[model samples]
Target: MAILFSRRKITAWCVAALASLAACGAFVPAHAENLDAPLVLVVGYAPGGSTDRMARLIAERLSPKLGVPVTVENRPGEGGRLAAKQIKRAPAGENVLMLGNPAVMVVAPLVFKDLGYDPDKDFVPVSQVSSYDFALAVGNKLQLDRAMFLVGRLWAHPEEAVFGVPATGSLPHFFGLMVGDALSVQPQIKGYGGSAPLAADLSGGSLPIAIDTMDSLYAQHVAGKIRILAVSGKKRASFAPNVPTFREAGMKIDADGWNTFFAPSTMPQPKVQLLATKIREVMQDPGLQKAADALYITPVVSTAAETAQMLKAYRQQWEPVVRRSGFAP
Candidate 1:
């Protein structure tokens, strides 16, 4: 026999049925209750870059620790803003995260007036993964030998002292301007799409001075195609201890480039903590450390709290420098 019920009765019946299912452990909410979902580590730059390389390494180790599949996705645009915006708009429980650096997290806010996301408001720092320093290098094609002498030439002929950077509004570009300010000379700034071309020109002697990260220039320096004038850090880099720091060279400049993990701010605290812990654990592995060393990167395993403090301090330190550079994107 068929039975028919009123609308209210049908509604109550459905509610009772759902409650029974809940009691029987058969009901699952739309939001995933487990961390079994696939995790994606988004890289702002395309494949073959340092960030992409590091992301893949972390993903390989992180997958085992989390007991879930981990993959790297390259978004590659707008100086990492594209990937950053994608992470910002991802679903809360999707397990999407971004590997961020100063270009996207620190400098974007100051340079891009219409940046799609705010580093402070849209994201949470998970952990700091790696760090490296920048270096002021002169191409073998140039007729100069020392950074001090270069400064003197800039003062003597500012028009001929242009510097090349990977991109406009990048840390290297700002640092180039800072160098000019310290020496009280104005030189033209050349922006490239990536370091490869800048490096090629620098090596070919068309571009005399190139300011770039140590890793980007280290190979050329090793090949005897470029001379690293001075690195920017308190102490000399381990890989290039012979290269004096900018401070030791009489320029009181200290800047270090770093990479950190970030999750959407909407993620739950427990999940955030779990991700942070897992990343820190993976970064501490000896094998990972060896790989980072080979890549000329220092693996820094910092807690979420420490990561947050580091970002805050970094922003504070660079804010004045960015302002002084008078750059806007």
Candidate 2:
């Protein structure tokens, strides 16, 4: 008779080995005392953007708490893959840390075949830091309902609506996919290198609609530069209460862009747990929450295991939507 081993059994064995190694102090504890090691926080965009600001904020708050000099390193190029590569190359047990997002972890690999690192396999997620909802900003070309109703109309519209996106596989790009999935209308998505170009094109009337962060939309909408048609959050944003969520509009759709921390996969579990725990602690700080609110972001916390589970679930939910968007890389 052939012997068979179940998947659970294999996982259990791996867990046991990791636990034993951790007890031996072979693994770096999450709260390792390496105060001199420069904790590099790598970001994928320019200094002024929301993502960069968030990274900086986290680094600032995390510095004193971790007793390390945390610094924000900007590597803004190639839709964040450059930063991802830089982190992947860092020596294990070093203080280098990469701020991972949906772009670097979820969508970029799907679009760029030559992506050198696998987020799911090459990096261990410490914790989910913050999240922001996206909005579909229309140019007042057509009067539409707030939130979900706008998505319905977009689905009903025969013409391919243009969604101005930041990068080819960034947050807005994925939001467009979910919109297309809900309404069954394939939106014509256009990618720009940065928000400046996107704003210019949208204001010039070349792009009729844009899928962007709530901050960008709220600022532009208030300035009469653009109009918000819908949002991709589960609930109405505090800044834009009139805008209904996809659930309220009778369409089941809710998604957001999240910022997380990831170290190289070879990182030990104890060190991973330590980082995850400390990040969760920092996320709950009232000061951090206030700072995050200013940027229209909400601090979210999750354990290392919980975040890993969340990533798996998100990938499962997005895979079909991505393939349908003709993202055949």
Please identify model 1 stretches exceeding 4 Å from their true place: 1-34
- Can you give the lDDT of residue 112 in candidate 2? 73
Candidate 1 to truth, TM: 0.85
TM-score of 2: 0.83
| lDDT (Cα, 0-100) at 89 in candidate 1 | 83
lDDT per residue, candidate 2, 42-140, as tens digits? 887778877788888788877877787889988888668888887787666576668878877887777778898888678888888887888877766
lDDT: worst 10-residue window of model 2: 27-36
- Clash number for each model: 0, 3
Each model's TM-score, in the order given? 0.85, 0.83
Clash pairs detected, candidate 2: 28-271, 30-274, 30-275
Task: State the displacement of the C-alpha of residue 116, model 1, in Å, after optimal TM-score superposition.
Answer: 1.7
Worst 10 residues of 1 by lDDT: 25-34
| Best of the candidates, lDDT | 1
